[model samples]
Target: MTERQILLVKNSWSYVIVKSEEAGQLFYHRLFEIAPELKSLFKSEPKGQSRKLINMVTLMVSKLQKLDEIQGEIKSLATRHHKYGVDPAYYRIVGAAFLWTLQQGLKDKWNEELEEAWVDMYAVISNAMIKNQQAVAA
Candidate 1:
């Protein structure tokens, strides 16, 4: 991510942190709505799962500039997700749910530039996860 993109993401995420719980609920609600079958992949209770989701997003956004530093951790996450039978295709669905949740959460602050930055960030993260998953399978 470019410095400007990182700034946009970080600034927007601050708003999200204020209402993290609702944002997480909205994310999962949208995710299940988009792909109900994915519900089976999650074993945790709703509240716990929501917390995990928000925590993961927070961690990723916080480390956006130093993503390389966390590649190992990201790969481990992908490996665990692969064990859960998470398909690479599901990443797009999750991205859509995430963007929608952010838009809903950010309200007036949502814009093309911010959307693009988030999309780019998601692409980077998802590609890393998918690549790691494929490597593990290989």
Candidate 2:
């Protein structure tokens, strides 16, 4: 991603962190609404799960420019997710939910440029996770 794209994601995320709890609730609500089956994959209480979601997102957004530095961590996350029965196809479902949540959270701030940057970032992250999943399956 370009420096501008990275900045856009980081700046937008700053607002998201202000209402982190609500954002996490919105994300899970959207995710379950779109893919109810995914709810089964999460075993923790909603409150704890929400915190985990926010923390994970925080890490990703903060490391946007230095994703390579977290490649091993991302891979480890993917491996754990695979054990939780997370299918590769679920990445798209999660991405859609995430984008929707961001749009709702950002309201008027959501725009084509921001959306494009987020979509690209999601793809990059998902690709890394999927690669790790595939390696584990092999």
In candidate 2, stretches whose alpha carbon ends up further than 4 angstroms from where it belongs are: none
lDDT, residue 32, model 2: 96
Candidate 1 stretches greater than 4 Å from native? none
Candidate 2 residue pairs in clash (backbone atoms < 3 Å): none
Clashing pairs counted in every model = 0, 0
- Per residue, candidate 1 scores C-alpha lDDT tens digits across 1-138 of 889999999999999999998888899999999899999999998889999988888899999999988898899999999899999999999999999999999999999999999999999999999999988877
lDDT per residue, candidate 2, 27-109, as tens digits?
99999998999999999988799999889878999999899889888999999998998999999999999999999999999
TM-score of each: 0.97, 0.97
Estimate the lDDT of model 2.
0.93
